[model samples]
Target: MFLTNVLNESDCQPIKKSYDQWYTFMDKNVEFWLPDSELHTKNHCARVLLLALLIGHQKGLSHEEKDTLGMAAAFHDSRRLNDGVDKGHGIRAAEYYKDFCREHELPYDVQTYYITSYHDQDDSFGLSEITNSPVVRERGVLLYKIFKDADALDRFRLGPNALNVNMLRTEEAHRLVDFAKDLLQKSNETNS
Candidate 1:
């Protein structure tokens, strides 16, 4: 998660500051379905969170908007039963997120809901069937794309060729390609 060298100063400082805070929040406050999993737990989610916030910084999303990314990151992969194409895990995670927020009395965001609900699906399917509502597309599309790209960035953990840059939905996501690799390597090393 050391970005001071890889990321430019403008991007590094804010995200570096935010990273530790969000990671801590996720560790303490968020719940994941596979806490012991190598692929889908906070290790993965935290990296995605960093990637999302880094892209959010470059895209000029507001702090509040970025907060939604944090919420999405905290819960997006929190409900996977298995690592192999768990089709409805996003839906399960979204439902769990709704209940978590209600019981905790925290404000629930619709964009976070949409982002979590459709993240494991293809953009064509997700956008056309579920995430494409005019309100969601208009208000949540960029965030959705950012969150998806962020999650996709972590595909390095699956393997090197696992990520296809062309599939990324944002220019900012493209910029973080190298950072994502290094982040995965470094974070895994640190965890190990």
Candidate 2:
């Protein structure tokens, strides 16, 4: 009931028809969480979805994959609350996703779980080790990578003045990083 009023069964009927029956159930409860001020917001999630869609399209993902990625982007930070405790938001979000899957009688794959659970971990989460695992390498690590990168891009957009160089890890992600740095530099120069 999280997305209860925001998005309904009709809005997700197409997704349900094309993918799995559980999509409708997932969509209904996906947006239930309230984000904290310091963390990302619905606006941030939207921006990340847009960016992820663009990147995914450029990467030539199928329509189904794009839809899945878009859904993930929307629900990535769905567990954040305004109290400033982001400790287990990803895990909480995954739990929500699992519940939705269970309610609709869908297959809950491990990759899907990790994709949602670690969307925000960044390099600090030691994802590289897991990603390097033969199993993950064989799957689609790129999907998760792009999702994280797109989310980071929007984070920089939300506070261009506060982003540091250390936040960037890939050349593709650096494009947004440089853009934010340039904006901040221009703002400082204008003030001076």
- Candidate 1 local Cα displacement, residue 96, angstroms: 1.0
> Cα deviation in Å at residue 113, candidate 2?
1.7
lDDT of each: 0.83, 0.56
TM-score of each prediction: 0.90, 0.63
Candidate 1 lDDT over residue span 149-173, tens digit each = 9999999999999999999999989
Q: Which candidate is the best by lDDT?
A: 1
Clashing pairs in 2: 36-81, 36-82
Segments of candidate 1 deviating more than 4 angstroms:
1-10, 129-131, 134-137
Q: Report model 1's TM-score to 2 decimal places.
A: 0.90
* Model 2 per-residue lDDT tens digits across residues 31-135: 656644444655455545655555665566777566666667656777775434366777777777778678978655555566677775655573774475565
Please name the candidate that would achieve the greatest TM-score relative to the true structure: 1
- CA lDDT of 127 in candidate 1? 74
